[model samples]
Target: MNNFTIYLATLLCLLASKVVGQETFETRAKNIAAKIETITKEEKSALKEEVEAVNNQLEKGSITLEQAENKKKVLAEARAINIEARVGKEQENLKNLVQEKVDGKISESDTIKKSNQLILKWEKGDKKHIAKNEKRTTSQFVFAAGLNNLVTDGKIEDSDFRFLGSHFYELGLTYNSRLAQNSNFLHAKYGLSLMYNNLRPTDNQNFVINGEQTNLETNPIHLKDSRFRNVYLVAPVHLEFDFSGSETKGNKRYFKTHQNVRLGIGGYAGFHLKSKQVLKFDDSNLEATEKSKGDFNTSTFIYGLSSYIGYKETSLYVKYDLNSLFKNNTINQNNISVGIRFDLN
Candidate 1:
């Protein structure tokens, strides 16, 4: 009689487990259906709002009717694609849930929690919303370093500064704004930058200020190193052309600049911040260093034309100053530089 009792209890337990498993599966399936419906509704509402915005633009004459229609079509197609993709992902989750149940990986006690977590994951992983909300203006950090020299009387060969020793560096923040509401091909880039231009004279020469003129003269101490540096705070403006393609997500398209081949033409204007000279020499078998701060007759105002051609974030950059390097001198000398530039976004 005890054996029969044990068998009956085991049978009851098996039936109860089957019933609970069936209930769990039913509950998860219902939750998946509801989540899919919610996703569709959200995308549809967003699409409606976007369409309304296009209509308003058309009414305001900001965009023509034909353009508005084209925009609406593109938006609709994008939204439809988003809905299809998101819903397909939810369906995949449901399939995985069934597979987990078949493999006995899911427990009845945690089924509801797991299903809720899956829905939450779907919400968090949706990148379409983020892509659709891209801003019209973006900012990036700019850094440039390269060879520095001067063009004396419009001739580079007559430069007094060492070709390889002289260097220039720039640091700044820039903003890029799309020129058109719908196109990313053209943009206006503007920013402020701090520029450092260093010149190392060749042939044991050092800069000497005589009266109103700054001239390079032979140093009597047989100098090992002599450098003159000028600092400037400048504002630069450029019209940039970006060839990177646009990406469509949901109801909007975003143009990411500096992702491909780009060309920029611009100019800058500012004033000299300060100037200093450094000298290092051997004096009586001892190393001596001298630092002198002065204007050195350097120009107080700075203006230059700059340009760049590049792929992605790095580019070949060149700039030439329009103003004279010195305030009063017999010969006109202008600073020039060529280097690699990076735009860190």
Candidate 2:
């Protein structure tokens, strides 16, 4: 099987196990209650340390997605086992004490009071544990693909643009942090991304850069393909508003990879990594290819404003660069792109 199929199979198995096992949670929790009571405080601390270590590995990208998911399963199972054990032990103790009260070893009033206190204690502990687990933010790698184009200052005819041939793509890692301590509606997302943008001119034209001047020149010969590409290594930060009641806790790590009806607005700044032009044509009936790489007189830096709005993994994305495409070029063509964004958080 392919890697994707294998991963899917493993994930299905894990999820199935959780579902099948969930039905026995009450029984298992009762059975393990005594064992949980026997666990020392130091042992509980050790468990926390182990979970923290796994989280560190995940954040550092040292573990694969499957590995991270498996680790999370292990941690959850440990917590469940601990919770069930404690509840079971408490129930057993309560039963024993009630039996004593029935035998007249304790006063009826005293027995009632003690039983109520025990029940309250269990509820409080369970609530605290559940609250702790719900507040964590999960981190993962993301890959996005989309189309791109340029928005110029002066009038550029639509016929002079090649939208399909000009493609824009990005790959990056993102961390989502809850804006409010108790609410997941607002979030702050920050990450480093490598963005590639290709611009293809229409009407058999190619980019020509001389010193600080950059312009599109029509080819003397018939051209099969003529493309200019710019690459950027940027750090982006966004403020996201999720109206799906998706709660995120900055202090804890939880795995909820996608959101419905989410909107994000952000800006990015980065250095221009490289720029190149490629030309392909038929020379004397023989296919020929030429690639030229240089300073290109393109801007050394790039900054842009970007936004996205969508449901689930796919979203409409728009980005507009504030800076000019070329540093000192005669024509001012700012890079602007509108396309679909796939976010695998």
Candidate 3:
């Protein structure tokens, strides 16, 4: 017989023999191997057993030869069905076990495969096409500066906003230095900034309450004749993240100049360094300045949350001072900035 036909016949015939013999799993596998002679030998044994039983019955005159042959055929078919069902059950159970492993719904430690050990051994034995993942590290530094808008909540009034450079201005610089890890593409950094601001009441008062210096205005300054301004410095340390595994992207690291908005709220302390007044109308500058000190207290101290947003290289962001500038200070100039911020990595 051709090999394909012979192999198929052996598979079917071996199943019948295996069931007849009540063989264990290991022995059945060995007997049903690719050796054609070994497989046919088991089939032959199964036929022999039937022939002896039939002959014994014939001698006793219980049945004819034809009856004996038909009985053997029926027994072989039943044996084949039993073995096929057993094999199918075993295969289905194995498939279920594999699926349970992938889902992680399986909690039993005994079921886990020791696949990592095998992988390690194989990689070590054949030193080809294998690499280990390591902690990343680096130190070449870079940095950038930018401006943002300012908004504030006041002690006496509700709230207001101003774009950078108009009633307000900001300057910031960031430094990305290397960590001590000694791996590739990994590090840390420190950031710093200085801000200036000017905020005034929307309406000027006809009468003034000189609380600080004792010079309230009468015919006080015209509503248009009042102005306010102040300045501060801030510093922050930002833990940076990066993706520069390949070449051709340039070595300049990533600078937060444009795109991608960043919202970060940390602790900050600002000292009111400068305070001044600009005359709005024809009156004494000292008198109007004294009456219009709404949100801006003389050298007010503030602490609170800060946040920002950016697009590619350009950004728009705002900060909310947590503390009041006035004793009744509600919220003051929030330092909303929109300037280029570069990175050093």
Candidate 4:
């Protein structure tokens, strides 16, 4: 080969070697940082296990409280010493990397600077590791209120229906089970709720169910109050999605407290706990109230489709019953409700 061609090939080989050396140095720096983290985590875990063992011994009456306390102090001091020793060793390893300079292909100053930057990056990642390990299934309490009504295929001719007093309230405790081990994007949400649904007919009217048929009946006296009430104990289950990102505050830790958008779609099945009606009238300068409690031809089993769309704490809630409001009723009326829901997490 010509002398110029040989020189060009040699230049390319040198350039490739330099690139590989730089990559190797960076990789080794990351490995060292990762090893240091793993060793420290293992040591902390051992210390926790030691403390737990001491507690177990004390609980079993094998050691007195004072002795257990002393043992805990000893274990803590030992852990501190272990950590100090490991940290010193890590520093020594880094110093050796700076001194050796990886076969002198890279300068010692450049190696130290690059290694320091890599170590800082890995240190920041430690918080992410901790968050991943700590994250798990969680739960929160919820409250909801809205307007409710019975929509039917048949209609009552002489009654004027209104939505003012036809309100519903629900209180529940909900739990979220994560679908993936290290993710909170998709979760299985389930909860137990107590629901109260009320409907008031306009123009002094009361609900009356005759045998298997249900309808609203008008009253002759000027009725001051008339309403129908039903209570339910339900278990709701849904698939909930959280569209929120993690943020770091003043501290270098990541938190997921701000869920900006959330959606839950699911169904619920419940049992009718009770059904009642109240009536009041003024007669001959006397005011009297009467209450009736019975099945009222209402369905005992309740199942429905429920959903909510939320931004932050407040959400619009909706529920539609699949079955008729009253069992074996001719009118075939179903209940529907819409309202707002709040999450207290």
Q: Write down the TM-score of every candidate.
A: 0.63, 0.59, 0.38, 0.58
The candidates, ranked best first by TM-score, are 1, 2, 4, 3
Summarize candidate 4's per-residue lDDT along 163-244 as a digit string, tens digits.
7678787756677776765455677888766677888888778877777777787887778888888877678998888776
Inter-residue clash pairs, candidate 4: none
Top candidate on lDDT is 1
Tens-digit lDDT track for model 3 on 1-345? 332233233233333322322223213333323222233235446645876887799889899878875665455444434433543443344344334433655443422223344356655653341221222332211112333334444332233222232344443344444443432233354443445555544434232334542221434445445445555545554443333332222322222211233333344554444445454564445433343333224434545554433433223444555554444323343443333332212
* Candidate 2 deviant stretches above 4 angstroms: 1-136, 154-159, 246-257, 283-286
- What is candidate 1's CA lDDT for residue 109? 62
> Any residue pairs clashing in model 1, and if so which?
none
Query: lDDT-based ranking, best first?
Result: 1, 4, 2, 3
Per-residue lDDT of model 2, residues 1-345, tens digit only? 432233233223223323322223222333333233344233446656887888899889999878975675465445535643553454464455334433656444654555566457655655664554465453434345566777777444573568787777665556777767666678888776667788888888998766669888898988888988887767788898876564344444443334468899999997675678999986677588889976588776789899999886567888878899899977688887777765543
Model 1 C-alpha lDDT per residue in residues 164-190, reported as the tens digit of each score: 999998766688888888888999999
Q: What does candidate 1 score on TM?
A: 0.63
Q: Which one is best on TM-score?
A: 1
| CA lDDT of every candidate | 0.77, 0.64, 0.40, 0.69
